[model samples]
Target: MQANYVFRVTVQLDPPTAHLDPDRFETVCRLPAATPGTDGWLFFQYNLWRGDIADADHMQSLLMEKLGVEVIEASFSELETDSAYRAALESEIETDLSRFNADSVDAVVHQHLGSSIHVRDAEAIPDA
Candidate 1:
């Protein structure tokens, strides 16, 4: 029922802020899998290209908002989804093949996610 985008962030602390606990962090943010062909469904399809963030500045802004901190560096990790959720997503995609302009669900998934999608058990997801 859920999919999350994983990211790693590093926040550099200036000398005056050196006493802060940590500078690097890893976190997951839930991004619900909207039905296929919707605006929400374009998030991954548009924002990421070739397994990388399409716009560093845009991603930086997103990280700042999600983490509520000044991020020195940030990188996308993966789209983690459970098997049940992935199956459901594929089923939904099957219903809207024309919107994706793909012949099959697998083609649409590959077009959008590239090679960054990871199917895992829900219990394995760490608390964000």
Candidate 2:
């Protein structure tokens, strides 16, 4: 049995950035629980991305240091299966067309750092 966990995080960027290089814009970080000898608590994940690499790094560091997000990780694979990732990308196009001209900052954040964890065989249980 396998379980998939997808985390959606919202971040606000000071200077708006374009999504030209979506691959370079996104990253993911994982923070394990702090309880002693605890098998399961919770894994906190964050996605950070923008137009510039420097901005992405700054956000990553902030989340790790100030936001109490530890065990930081970075990767592009997270977006492959994330539903929010797809939605966010689509939202960008919608925003671009809408008259309100609303900026999709939330989608931008997820586009950069969103992640998904698949727990292998974690859902299997023996019959009692």
Candidate 3:
């Protein structure tokens, strides 16, 4: 089964050195509209699949590093999907697995499910 996951991340600029003018700042950032009620603040919002959540952190880090801004707030706006909302997630998975010629969803899931590795520390990840 597949579900929709929406993420809304807001960031603020610390400009590194001199303060940035919104117009000039837009050159580096694609969505250049200034966040309401504040200058040098911006937002990035999107909807992705639940399985892609881990990749989202990598995306956030990349954006923060690329734009030289810090993420002030990050949130998941919507996380549930119903029968009324139909998507092509299965086909997408098929396309992704085409290189391996995975014949079906079960095949793909079985092939990759346990491949991801996890590490443990004192806090978030408990020792096995």
- Compared with the true structure, all predictions reach lDDT values of 0.70, 0.34, 0.39
Tell me the TM-score of each prediction against the true structure. 0.71, 0.25, 0.29
Instruction: Give the candidate number with the greatest TM-score.
Output: 1
Model 3, C-alpha of 116: deviation from truth (Å): 22
Better of 1 and 3 by lDDT: 1
Minimal lDDT window, size 10, model 2: 36-45
Distance (Å) between predicted and true CA of 108, model 1? 2.3
Which ten contiguous residues of candidate 3 have the minimum total lDDT?
41-50
Q: Please give, for residues 14-80, the per-residue lDDT of candidate 2 as tens digits.
A: 3347543322233343333223112431122233233222344544565557444342333223322
For candidate 1, lDDT tens digit of each residue in 25-128? 54444445554445576677667765677788888887778656776676767778888777877887898789778899888777767788898888875545
- What residue runs in model 2 are displaced by over 4 Å at the alpha carbon? 1-57, 66-80, 83-85, 97-128
Per-model tally of clashing residue pairs? 0, 6, 0
